[model samples]
Target: MATATTTAVFPLLLLFAAAVAVPSSPYLSPTTLFQNYQKMLTNFKIFIYTPAKPFTFQNPAASLFYSSLLNSPFLTQEPTEAHLFLIPFSPETSTRSLARLVRDLRINHPYWNRSLGADHFFVSPTGIDYSADRNALELKKNSVQISVFPVISGKFIPHKDITLPPVNLAARFISAVPENASTSSFLGYLKWDGKTESNFVEELRKDGDFLIDIERELLDPVENVKNSKFCLLFYAGDVAWMVEAMALGCVPVVIVDRPIQDLPLTDVLRWSDLGLLVAARGGAKRLKEVLNDVSEEKYNVMREMASAASKHLVWNEEPQPLDAFHMVIYQLWLRRHTIRYARRESF
Candidate 1:
């Protein structure tokens, strides 16, 4: 019995030794893994052309959108590289001229059609006049994805088939202060010139609630907001700024004219869902009630939820605008690859 046990243990030991000795494939090796990761990252080269200087939220949205794609398990880091190209918005370079330039590049560049193709995405928030007006819809039909966020209407002809993705508000990071807190009740800080029309301020004042407005102060609004239980967003400026306010632990009272219609992201984000949102017309009374009823326990719970949601705002996280952009690019790449493979096999 002792001899048999020894024999069994010997074989097991040998097997273990053999397993340890065998080298993993280069793809599995640590050095190889790092190299492949770097290689994968080089795949998608993003080229952004923005004439509106100083890298504003609109331009940064494109970068943030692509960065979000890194969260996907299917995304090989090499296949999603990005680059930015800036064009000047000048009187000499009219919007029509820029549009012509974009069209010319798509038609003239050979690789532009193959690798860059219509699937290669472009975002211009300023207007076609600032960049190139090459019809994004036409590019999308061909296989490139182009998104334009025009500051004004009637600048670019609307594409009948292509619908712009909804603008997402980072709702998860918002926190509401309980009524029992000794701090100020003000909800948000804004650069109010005393001339800018704010529906929130007007409504609150009408409801006999006083609002503290500190216009154009370089002072940190977060410090003021931290002491307050609530902050107010009168109009939609940049979704990022809204998210920033939420990060500081204040609940937002978003004031919108059409509560549901004007916003592009009404489907995924509801005012009630974030425990935020006040309609321009009938929200003042509702806002007061919500503020008054919030208890310490409930406020803490909402704060946690908002913090969890804020994680999605990070560039390399799922369910963001970048993931949508990656899906479009990958689909186009697979289609083209399949066609080429089929032709090769036939030949």
Candidate 2:
């Protein structure tokens, strides 16, 4: 069973990894990265702990990710051969329930005790926090957490914890702009709701460089994005907007003040190549300077890259080559070196 699973999975993953043209590090050759990725594909095995009842997710990102993982060839029923153990649960599942699940795994399975969850991982769009209640410290501290929001805090350790793109599985309302579509009216478009009101945000709203579409006034929100050269994104809780903006062929200008992170697929996709990142700390004046400074030649290059990178953010019904699902697997493969497995007694 493991042999069959291994054989079927490797080629798809290898193809996905090979298709990634951008190297995460300039020092590493593409051939070296591909070789490393091939090794991960051949050896990495995941053991998903069966839940007492099947999980039902309300969030599309969580639903698609969990379901796709179950059907993927990385799954192995044999615990002894597993490199990572996945604790499957819905995003709506309470922290208490999640902690209980971990406790059950610790008591029932010998694997959890081997490395104390150093090789374990879980996927949550909103993220799991056992720290607030002062519970499951081992799992919280040791296990790899894959979340859509990778905040710049102690809560989300970059490179240690993984980032998953918040994928909207629904069919796009506007897939592509028409060939004869009108030229962009504004340099950038921001969908604002006045929820997070600040001097900087308000200043940006009135700036001539951007077209601020107040949420209540939006007739066609997607169209606003399509008609703009750049789509402004401010991360509140969800990042589905980032994916949407990318799919619409709009270059994303991710704005975050401090706590939040805007980059997804840090290892797989070159974010700088696709879009511009503006730190909100500089306020509207600085932001305008940065956006205006972008040369016409540079903007064209980013627009082209954004179009190509858009497919990687979408969650297809069936996992496709170099899609979000395969990219997460690649990230996990990169972090596989952190796993310290204990020697087991032979039967």
lDDT of 2 by residue, 1-347 (tens): 43654466667656545545743221123465566555655577889888777768776666777788888877888988887888877767777877778788878889777777778888776665644432256666677888765443555756567777776654234455333223777778887766654566689767776788766388887777777888877765334677777767677888776644435667766676677778778888888888778877677666656765666677888875557787678778777657532333110
TM-score of each: 0.47, 0.79
Q: For residues 94-195, could you state the per-residue lDDT of candidate 1 as single tens digits? A: 446545554665575443434333333333443333232333333323332233221343333232111133233443334342233346555334434454
TM-score of 1: 0.47
Candidate 2's C-alpha runs over 4 A off are: 1-43, 90-100, 130-135, 150-154, 169-183, 198-201, 259-262, 339-347
Show the lowest summed lDDT stretch of 10 residues, model 2. 338-347
Off by over 4 Å in 1: 1-93, 111-118, 127-193, 198-200, 206-210, 216-220, 236-241, 259-272, 289-301, 308-347
Per-residue lDDT of 126 in model 1? 38
lDDT for 62 (candidate 1): 54
Count clashing residue pairs per candidate.
Answer: 29, 0
